[model samples]
Target: MRTRFRARPRKWGPLRGLLAAAAVGVLVFPAGASAVSAAPLAEQDLGSRLAADYEAAFLTQYNKIKDPANGYFRQFGDLLVPYHSVETLIVEAPDHGHETTSEAFSYYLWLEATYGQITGNWEPFNKAWRSMETYIIPAQKDQPTNSGYNPAKPATYAAEHGDPSGYPSRLDSGVSVGQDPIANELSSTYGTNNIYGMHWLLDVDNVYGYGFCGDGSKNAPAYINTFQRGEQESVWETVTHPSCETFKFGGKNGFLDLFTGDSSYSKQWRYTNAPDADARAVQVAYWAKTWADKQGKGSQISSAVANAAKMGDYLRYSMYDKYFKKIGNCTSPSCPAGSGKNSAHYLLGWYYSWGGADASAQYPWAFRIGSSAPHQGYQNPLAAWALANDPQLKPKSATGATDWATSLNRQLEFLQWLQSAEGGIAGGASNSWGGSYGTPPANSPKFYGMAYDYQPVWHDPPSNRWFGFQTWGMERVAQYYYVTKDSRAKSILDKWVPWAINNTTVGTGGSFAIPADLQWSGQPNNWTGNPSTNTNLHVSVLNKNNDVGIAASLAKTLLYYAAGSGNTQARTTGEKLLDALLGNTDSKGIAVPETRADYNRFDDTYSQGGLYVPNGWTGKMANGDTINSSSTFLSIRSFYKQDPDWSKVQSYLNGGAVPTFTYHRFWSQAEIATAFAVHAELF
Candidate 1:
């Protein structure tokens, strides 16, 4: 059974000191007019309107259910519940029971900090900060205080009883700061101890390190220590375990276990140290140490630097060469011994599923190495960002060493290598094993899968099949270019961005007809002579569908690239796309034709009216899919100044009643608040 953390609705609790910090005095601007003469009303005045509305909404809702003990705004019977969850139109009032994750809350914290920085008012920030310190952080640390293992108990008893140490291994999800350790734990099948919780702590530290701590915040140190303690506990768990201690490779003394389980739950490979997880852990530790070092407070984060180095060593020596092999007609010496047509550059299997060796044969066919899955496009860039940010993780030698930056470049190169002459990058690549997972003929280089839901499916693969969300990878690449000014990254964006813009469909009134995605597929080498020869398998749209999230994402990437590359056309096209997105909104600030949908499921029952922005319009596909409005908001916030309809958007969002949406209410509200805060330039 898939154990999900479900939240239950609870009555609004009493407010003690929460009411005293309500956002004071609304800053109203001229209605329906631009506050700045040169800017549109949507751009200049929209932010103020959003600010006022958000403040009002936050105070009104917060006062109703502020937990007196911790000042956390609790609703839906969960602690630290974001205000957006309450305003969703899908679940209705008094029953807003959406589950919140550590990842989502991390985004919320960023929004809060950014909102506070952009807007002069820090009341909301203060509230969120207090809640995180007093409630959220404490909840994350809630676990067994004593060491979970007992020598007298049977070896299997450790698994049954679980880790008793009150370390920060628990990645809490749902309402409130703390919940049942076993129930709230993520990746439980692979042992409750994982790096996700430590990742969350890193996020908290980042929020403070970014600038919140410099402002004389009182609780920043405590939060930092909490994260450090968690990291220490994780290290202790790994070293103390007999299984982990006994595992060895090349005469090495230590083994970094990635996940805690075996192959039973399709996690056979995750039990060993994973490159991705190790990379993240290294980055977190590096950043924590950097923060501590900068503050002239080295003692507070003593173990951070050493911990990061240890993880970095594991990634560099153990995981990199063991799992990651070069491929795709490479002439370079770095390619593995068996590099050729069958060999492809790919991250073996999401992570080293098991320790010490490449165990590719045990899993599903499509998940093995050489697949070059599109999901890696997203993860690789993040890993790159972490490595690029820290010097310790850089390559130690000038030759034959692949550091995080080199890894990022290789990943980017692989994506470009997969691109067809038509400019559409293959969402996935499969070798001869494709037939094992339902592909015809089970031959090598079979392009017979649809790219959706971040998974490559073998169905009627569209010639121009591409995942909309994967375009965000371009943004990461652009960010890399901004930092390193790498010409290769620039060249990739230059080629892909133009192709993306040309394929996008816009209506007469500036509304997007089809969302931003690739519109052409490459020719199949074996099954057909060329793409034109296979009309039966070819899939094309009539320029009537719009993926709002993808559209927003593409526009944001364009804006970022334009800023770096000074590409006037990219900037212009990006602004126009954002304007088209704004055109979808009604006078009340709610996006219309909102639908509740996912990759495999579509439901348009709640399409008529909602408070938050809909994911995207159900166009020709009519899949009833809409993403979280917060995503759209974040994308828009990226280039609000360039958008021509800024004032109108601001007015719509600021019209006062909180906008509603079908799902992910907490994310939507937090994003809306973030957009408004960003516009206000509080950060």
Candidate 2:
């Protein structure tokens, strides 16, 4: 009975919410109904263009200094500005002439590090790192075909050709929530090659100090040999696949390789001139090292040892030699639909679960990487963390142990074929990349009530459709109910944590690289599926709506990591939705900042100041800036795990005080390891 996902659930039939406010009311939205005003070159002309690029941005420590719009304004406008608002609401009314070189380089790096960590003034972090190096431009031509580093658009380049049912390419390519021509073909096919070159070395080590912004004491191996010559020319000419071996092409290894000869990457995801899954560098290391590193735990143990050597050969040759390939004396089923053990549990669960990385080199029960699975309804928390770490993944089976029990019994039958009749887990819209990849209608739908809200395995998605498939199925079932406590995953985490805190548009107004999946076209997750049009994304199913609650902030960070961490009722329900997120500038001498930008329109001071470095602690601290999607970095790590308890590891072992976007790897390693694996299954 591999049928597994039978379906039927949909409920929220108009006006009703508070099962937890659809996963804890929008984590980032300071003011809505589209406020309006300010037309730019103003607001003190962006602090006078950061006082004219403040001495090459104090040479780099203050960070930004040379981008100029080709690099999407310092990664979505200066590191997604003190929590994004499209520079005081993109010219009013439903957002006029929208702005985003990545939200104007995150609003010039929060106006020079929120006025240089509060009036100490590195001259507004050296003029907001030179107004985030005027959105860093360069590749307007040079390498012609595709050499990498490509971020140009602030002329708002609106061509808009995308909705051929290929689900959501920013709402089928009507394309212009301000710049996303498939991120310039994902920076010329996965950033000039070197496939995910550590996500363009985390925007050249957070705007030039070095790569993936690490090795920094202000990095120097001559800056890792001048950024490994753009990471070996983006891994030998634009990720055509030159890690040398290990499957060719890029993304889904460009249509499953029989190895059709000579490669520059391109095996599965797509490339015979590229068709669907635009594969925006299939999340180059989640946004390369979880939002430009330097937040704590020693760069989280050097980003979990280079994410265990980039998923250590897909947990040893795609789940221990392709799930024993038919089993001993074997010779068959190598790639065919096994899809290299579910693409190594979907890129090691978005890079070791947001780089807090649960180690042993991520191999969560590796049943040939959740083989023949994907119809959608959930099961890819990076292949259930390598099939729940199948005893311990690796190739030790020639003897001396480690056969991984028939691929961990198909990894608990692919997580009970991605459950749904209401018990939760709905990411099953399977297209394993080849032909007819079925199963994903929010994993099947019809689960008895909620008017059968199945719709989310991708119908229309250029941004936040299917809430990135229910935030990738509640981040692979809240990291499998925090590492297998499994009381039926704590009774579907108690009815999917109030159906994702009362029903969905995700934490309210925090989305940027949006795409939640659920559109055949009528459109209305509060409507802005902005893929260029009067809109078109719906795939059918319908009912519940709660303004698309970040798919209920993944059950409000899995009931605040099952109520163990900082839990005073999920930090007074995340400081009462961060105090109903009004129009920015709350200016209490700005410090405890966070953002959730939707602003294509809305003004009258929609908050600007920055310096949000929280977690285990670092300096000035920040959080807001919510939309590079995946439900705006998982609700900015579930709004800093609220903080009623573990006072960030008891104020960093006592010395106390911390939060410049503090120690977070998805709220410090997968939300306190799912709060010690669902601490005694509450709910």
Candidate 3:
């Protein structure tokens, strides 16, 4: 039921003509390597050997991502936005292939940053930030009502439900909510009340046709969102809506009534920020600054770095609990509302959100941080370190650096607390139990008074099931360890690296296998006390796969750990893994065949784990597809039926063979490209 795009084996598909032309750059090999060398690469030194391969790998992947003909990016007015994938029929995080996420934008920045590091060109990196700002981050025109935001009363409380049938949670003004601690400081520091952060989702092709603020003109790259119901509500069950709601689409109150129940619904504009993506952008900026400085070109990126600092300053919102409630053993909605830093968890939660009534409306705006500090995949210690230590990237706000400095240590401690007996990190801790501030079971494990959840934020397929989170989160720790020789970070990665390498397989003939899925058991002891090792906590590898993106991430983690700790097997495994990945490369990017049996759920009804529309709550998508009790995932957006890959999915729906696809996801490609650069630079 949980169908967000995870790292899976996928096949290559033909490109779709999606954007205007841009000149293709030729690959510039490093000085020590030849354009046509017949000599065996094995004979050369590691640096000389990998320099050519890494440069070529980075350039090939970069050109594939940037070139318009490849269909990875599309021209959105004056700016550009990358697609989720080159194909149109895929289903994952974004329902449609053309729909992009902040994750993609961050990866795009990373791709450009690597290019600047390799080619010494910083224009592309700056341009990436500009595009991110112009498209994803809501402009003054989009928000238009931050002036109405009240720091004293941020947002009213709404109890979260476990399923879609829990008809729009009613807003209760009587519930106590905390004040916005940093709102005034951030506004005074930046001279603006408007948040300077990227909203998590965008419809790059406007496939659903919810044009800007529902003015009705179909436009590309319109802001949109899904996944609001609860942990059980996966992408397959979502009812898409525009970010700037104007009551012109969906039901009478736009799509607001479907998610929240109130006495009177007001037309509004809202956006959710995926903290990990924004954090990754800052992490990328730090690397960009470091690389550029090495080439005596740091000044060229100073402006962009400053903006990253600004974004980081706003990112502190993620440190607070949702509704700004006190962090600890509060088991009810009546739990004490926190003031100042008491609400700060110091860990990056899943998301931070803000919204306001239309600029003309009388109602005020609201902001909320996430209460669930779930998936470790979202943590970025490197970025936290940069914001805390690097003067260039230090946030301009008064307490931003201090907060990040505390966050750096806290994140490391969180990692230490979550590590399992077998060394795999467990899920996470949550201040708001079950997302409603409900009482947790007595004697439940706790981390700093917050309850431990094996699968924190979401529960469809279990949030921490995929091994990708381990590698993704550990890679940052490894990098932080490699840079600062932080004993805490090293101590954590020392156990994680060996466990990951033990599960990974790098064989001859381009054959390789890394952890695909994981199964966890037991829980860590109370970290509020002495924080002992989790002797009872354990993990088992459920499966193995050659998912290129995850493999690249695992390799990076190992390489960084090996580089810092002098672990020979880690270095060899990382090098061999990278070498194996090159064999999977193609014209568009690296991918392998994926058989999508999950596509069968496209037509499933509510009982079968599909979209659940409340009876009589009739509405329509932009294309006029009706939304009611009978609607399935495919029924609401008829546009997908016209996709070129529709027939294969259709056949599968009709009980035929499962369709296999090779997708070129923007974020995965960027990760692969950067993985090569990471190897070359560190080695």
Candidate 4:
């Protein structure tokens, strides 16, 4: 997802006052680690000048990021959970900055992995995983009824609508769904039916009062969710609810009636996993293993590596259809149900979800994969390769490694199929049109019988509109090419890198601009052994801005491509962009001021991108805010007005000019650190 935001600058809340205690050395230890310090930067002399400079840069950013005084993380008892941003007033993919995501946790892993590479200390990397396992991944106690899941009857069918107005979509049990191919195998291998993957979202501070398993105990890091309606449901238009619904808040059935039309609602727990974030965790673990092995400290990170492998095992759920319907050309509900692996698409879809009734209930649990494999941004060939080829990372399940091996090649081919004539990759393909196996427009481009969609999953601002997806996806491709010297990957980057470089500008005094919003025309040709380029398929840079996170990510992609291909221009551009980034460094981390014109949309109604509660349907948030047919985004979320930055947005809502703010997002800061570390390690 794009790390864009809208807000005016505001000071952070109270700092933790622990910075001075951990500032004694160059290496910053995580909270709960030993109080000892490493050697001073002046004393440790790396032989190479480039190594020393980049290492120092990495350390500078790393210290600010991990400093409790900066507020990037909150230490709950012994666990450290990273926030989406240091500022609580922010809204992007998450409604509040304090809310954490699996994406943030993955970047946390990357930050510590780079630290281990630079300082020969692997404990921090291991510690990060331990924290992720404890807080984000739902525990057995959290998912108490998984033992009742039935592979034969995975889930009843529910047609997804296009917008919030079309929600509470009726569940139709008349449609036939396929059997789950991997559930039995996974349960047998792990000796448990519980899922091991991390849930995508968490209310880290329990800001919404969705306490532990919906018991309302004020527990921090509670499971919560938003964006269940449809593609038209943007962050501003979502109604937040507890993942474990217990009628503690909202209407008679909690928030269930708002999204699904069921005869009766059950008190249950559910979770949605973002596949990209989980793949990214495995990708970082691979790098940690590679770097530690070179230092003879591989054993220090062996446990974390094995856990990453296990996560990959469960992550395979993303490769199947939502109801496990047979893939390709199924335009009606009468389409044949898949028997085994026929439903497997072998590509990473948007999400995979699971849920079940409360512990005392006797109903069976349900699981579902996704049908839309949108943006190439989600693919992680390197992670797939590691799971299939690396002995330490190969999954324990009998067919897990084999499944990932197939996914690796299929993912690469997908990249080749979607690459445009102008070099940028186009949007992805969907098996179920309109999210219900509906018919597509005549002559629609196809990939393995799935129709191409320029904006696949979400559609409010359009999923493929942001250029960050280009950089994010290509970075993985560049890494794959760098590691394997695979000519296929190089060919794809050969076209994409120059197109990106042509659009990017890095200048003096940290003034730089990279493609921000993108506009696309036409579509890629249908897939073939030798897929022909659709000359009609094209992409244009609609706008540009200096998003520090995207710039750092772009630099990583370019540097990796340059190191592998030995291209002089790519190396020069990457180095220049990275040098430009250091000019913007601040006390918290590197950042640039952003004008959040979109903040005006905060109070918008359904017609204007705000919350749309159905008519005559009434509910109440835990804070007792009334939810009704006329509720605006701000109406139910009265908490936003309590934010310190609310005045700026309030003034803007009152017809003032848009407010501007410099955001210190956790993932961006970690990316800045890792960019420097990668440069030091490679060159």
List where candidate 2 sits over 4 angstroms from the true fold: 1-419, 427-498, 501-579, 583-585, 588-651, 654-683
CA-lDDT, candidates in order: 0.32, 0.24, 0.81, 0.83
Q: Looking at candidate 2, what is the lDDT of residue 274?
A: 10
lDDT of candidate 4 over 1-683, digit per residue (tens): 11111111221100111132124445555544442332223322222335656776777778889878999999977668999999988878888899999999999999999888888888889889999999999998788898888899888888877878998989888999999989999999989999989888899988888798777788888998887877777888888889888898899999888888989988888888888899999999999999999989899999999999999999998898888888888788788898889888898888888888887786656555545454577888999999999999999999999999999988888888888888888778888887778898898888888888888877767787778788889999999999999898999999999999999987777788898887888888888856567797889988889988888899999999999999878877887777778778677888889888888888898777688998999988877889998888788889889999889999999999788888899988999889977888878
Candidate 2: 10-residue stretch with minimal lDDT: 222-231
lDDT of 1 at 226: 13
lDDT of 2: 0.24
- Cα lDDT for residue 76, model 4? 78
Model 2, TM vs. native: 0.24
Shift in Å, residue 284, candidate 2: 17
lDDT score of residue 455 within candidate 4: 83
RMSD, one per candidate, in order: 17.9, 24.2, 4.4, 4.5
**2 versus 4: better TM-score goes to:** 4
The parts of candidate 1 lying over 4 Å away from their true place are: 1-97, 101-106, 109-113, 116-377, 380-385, 392-403, 430-467, 505-510, 516-520, 523-547, 582-590, 595-683
Query: Which is the winner by lDDT between candidate 1 and candidate 4?
Result: 4
Root-mean-square deviation of Cα positions for candidate 3 versus the true structure, in angstroms: 4.4
Residue 586 of model 3 has an lDDT of 67
Better candidate by TM-score, 1 or 2:
1
- How badly does each model clash, as a count of residue pairs? 36, 188, 8, 0
- lDDT for each residue of candidate 2 in 1-683, tens digit (9 for 90 to 100): 00011111111111011112222212221222121111121222211223222221111111112222212122333232221121221111111112122222322333333222222233333343333233221121111222222222211111111121121112111222121122233234223421211111112222222221122233211011100111011110111111111122112332112122123322111101010111111112222222223232124223322332232222222222112112111112222222212222221111110011011223211101112123333323323333234322222223111223333333334333333333334332212211112122332221111111223222221212244345434544554555455454444445545544444332433321122233343321211112111122233334333222232234335444444332344323322322221111111110112221221111111121111111222111012223121221113223223434334323433454432221111111112112211221232
Clash count, predicted structure 4 = 0
